[model samples]
Target: MAKRRKMNYASPSTNKIPVIFSIAVILIGLLVVMSSLKKFTHTPDQGAIEENVQMKNEEFINRLVPVAKELHQAHGILPSIIIGQAILESDWGSSELSAKYNNLFGIKSFSPNDDSIKLKTKEFKDGKWIEINANFKVYASWEDCMRDHTLLFVNGVDWDPYLYQGVLLASDYKTAANALQAAGYATDPDYASKIISVIEKNELYQYDK
Candidate 1:
């Protein structure tokens, strides 16, 4: 008897297996797509967040702008420096310096012979920084400090950053920041950037330049 020839025809059972595998692959692909979409999806609570920020900024301006204007009018100086100094040193007028001293510029006592009342400061005496109970100019009011600032700048004090009274004062904020940095007016790590930031953000330069 001749050996039976092996049949090469695929049975219905073979077709069923591929169909089941294809269905599983399609389902897996769908699941993968869904998971990828889920990971990147974001629900935006749009207007509410922006509105709160705007409101807070408005409130800050409402409370603080008068002080800036008063400082500006009292002395022919641009209020941006005062406002920037106040905002930076005072952390938007919340620091102890702002509350009690109201000396926004961190003005140090330059002269012992001078009669301006002073604050005890830490100064390097021999090798280490020592706390010296010495005089630092005290202001009866913010207006007084503002006046002193004006005088200090008018005299072209070494640390007068803007040197506003100079004949060839900087025409813009960047120039002022650079001139100030070169003049040793500020020891801030980001003095130029900070001043420029405040000037630009608040549009405070409009008052003078």
Candidate 2:
């Protein structure tokens, strides 16, 4: 009976091998796609982070420019120095002391009756740094804080009314920065240099005009 056609049927296991191979290939492709997506969605690069920081700094400077100019016109405090100190002391008004209490200049309050808050701060002393708790002035707004800061230079300490007169007399940022350091506005020995660097780097002198 015409020799029964030799039948060669594939085994279930053999069929499963191709299916498994296809599934594995598909899984590999999916893995590759997921990896690519992860890379695409990764966090911002260092350059992006720096750009963001620069933008924020610019915003801080811009926000202070008008007020600083006004104060400069009225008080003779150089806008460059005012803006630079704010940048350095307040960290562009991002510091907890400045942001929360509007104490942009780190102005301390010596009297118990003053509107103030006690906070820990670092002071440069004996050629080193020390942490100390101090009372810092509190203000109702940034503008008010700025006005108070100007007033400090204008009014000076009770013991020395002309302590910061050198700053007001300064014709340039460098002189004003040095005057601030000479007047002991900050305990940091490098305070003047730091302020000058900030002013120059940001072209804060332009605001002085």
Candidate 3:
């Protein structure tokens, strides 16, 4: 092969056996690194606590979501409006009546001629809950109240959306809330403020966006 090329080679400090040992050492190091990462990431208690909080929030959201979604579907009103209304009316489930009666909106109805149905209600007279017999429309369930709310918007002859759209075209949440109040949605002077409070406090508007 013409003057054959000379090849020179030198053995490392260790032979193939040492190479095997080095490979084993590398594998062990890699395993240790992986294990450390696993340990760092394994926060079972934290995960469980976070999950519980999420579940509670989900339950609260579920309780309020139907009202918001219903109004959104029927009137194109932001679900936030409904959520806010519930909060203001129900006091975030802290109201004594809300806990017992589930009447979040405090809607009223009584036979004009007869005092057949009377219910206990709270009034802010001198800042106290007064057990007075008030005329209120009782429902079979809370769901009925939300349904009725939507229907009022659609069925009210003079105050229906068809009639009021032009009036509320520039409607912000505050304007719409005030418009509803002016249309006799509620008697309370602070009605709109209450709805706005609930929506903002719970961040209920997130449901829409």
Give the count of colliding residue pairs in each prediction: 6, 0, 0
- Residue 18 Cα positional deviation in candidate 1, in Å, after optimal superposition: 60
TM-score of each: 0.52, 0.84, 0.55
* lDDT over C-alpha atoms for residue 12 of model 1: 88
lDDT accuracy of residue 7 in candidate 2: 91
**Please, what are the lDDT tens digits per residue for candidate 3 over residues 100-134?**
65566776664575322466765645555456677
Lowest lDDT sum, 10 consecutive residues, model 2, at 1-10
The TM-score of predicted model 2 comes to: 0.84
- As for candidate 3, its clashing pairs are none
Candidate closer to the true structure by TM-score (higher is better), 1 or 3: 3
lDDT of 1: 0.63
- Give lDDT tens digits, candidate 1, residues 1-209: 99999989888898799889999999999999999998899765778888877677556555655765665565544566656655665565554554577665666667766445445654544556676665455566655665676566657756654454532255555776665556555555467688879878977777553
Flag the better candidate by TM-score, 2 or 3.
Answer: 2
Using TM-score as the measure, the top candidate is 2
Error of 2 at 137 (Å): 1.0
Model 2 Cα lDDT, one tens digit per residue, 16-68: 99889999999999999999899779798999999999999999888888899
